[model samples]
Target: MTVASITDLDVTDHYAEALHEVIEAKAEHRAPTPTTGEEKTAAPVVDLMAALEKSVADARERRGESSGGSEATVHEMPAKPKKKTAAKKATAKKTAAKKTTRRKTA
Candidate 1:
């Protein structure tokens, strides 16, 4: 007879086994996994919407506008691409190639 605390109920061997059994049973009864083709088709729309919403929220926050929700306003700087000079680009390419070679050999 082991005394179990509330937290112990979640962490003990008996509870863990029970949880695993429940998860396995649920997984077995669930529908088949969606095909990669279906995922690829739907993923872009979701990603685009998410990116747009994030951009709007970021723009609002930077201008000190409040969101109607309980979430804190997160100010984000607009992403600017680095202006690469010929010298910098050559140095970067050399370093990147060196890194790849070292990784492959290691």
Candidate 2:
């Protein structure tokens, strides 16, 4: 009675049942049940180089750069101020502790 959306993976009831079973098994602290033959098939292999190239291309296009990597320039981040030394921090803590000790002793 249910119609699958175009965006839905072709998996149907098996996917839902498998997901539910896995969730239950995980909740019970039990090992996952073995997948059926249909589920045993390997997922499509990814081309890392191609994917990276595509991502870079898309990013460059968004930033108004052409496909050529070298011509693309990135904006520089503003420099942050350096933190005070550990010695300064320790001295501040020691000063506070000395004041606390004097108050307690008095």
Candidate 3:
């Protein structure tokens, strides 16, 4: 058996037709009739992140763990002196000591 081409297939856009009918009904201030036999019902919108967080919280609760409410402590590192500055201070101290020794010897 040969397969039918897409051009030969009869396609009907039920959604577009339904939407157009609804728009026209609203303009005429009348309730739109059901375009298809089945009535469309909207599913509840869910927040996936919130749901996952709640699931994790529930699991933690079942395991006898508390929902973490503590704020994280951030540690700030002290700034270090530059290598050149440290080296200069060391050389200055060494020269000062040498000068004192030379004066004592003299």
Candidate 4:
């Protein structure tokens, strides 16, 4: 099998560019236009921390959980592995302690 080249790829590039511009212009026309001549302003910067806190509370409220201020606890989002491992270790220690106490009393 033989592969063929179109000699000048620039012609194809120009057509592609023109077609993209036409499609974008048509799409802009289809969208609703604002009546005011004033330019649309970008949205205000958001405090991500505050927004996340509110979101968590809202979600907890929907789940029928208490959204108390003093009792509010934020769990770490990223998995450290250390936390779960530590929890397992702590549980094991407690069980071991109980077994040792039972053995000593018996």
TM-score of every candidate relative to the true structure: 0.22, 0.30, 0.30, 0.28
Task: Name the lDDT value of residue 49 in candidate 3.
Answer: 100
Give the true-structure RMSD of model 3: 17.3
| Candidate 3 lDDT tens digits, 56-76 | 889888999887954458999
Model 2: colliding residue pairs: none
lDDT for model 1 comes to: 0.66
Error of 1 at 100 (Å): 99
Q: Is candidate 2 or candidate 3 better by TM-score?
A: 3
Please, what is the whole-model Cα lDDT of each candidate in the order they appear? Answer: 0.66, 0.78, 0.79, 0.67
Off by more than 4 A, model 2: 1-39, 69-106
By lDDT, rank the candidates, best first.
3, 2, 4, 1
The clash count for each model shown is: 0, 0, 0, 0
Tens digits of per-residue lDDT for model 4 on 1-106? 2234545333345556656767777888864333334478899999999999999999989999888864747888886575444345533434434344344564
- Flag regions of model 1 displaced more than 4 Å: 1-46, 69-106
Candidates 3 and 4 compared by lDDT, better number: 3
lDDT of candidate 2 vs native?
0.78
lDDT of 2 by residue, 64-104 (tens): 97776576477999999999876655434444444443445
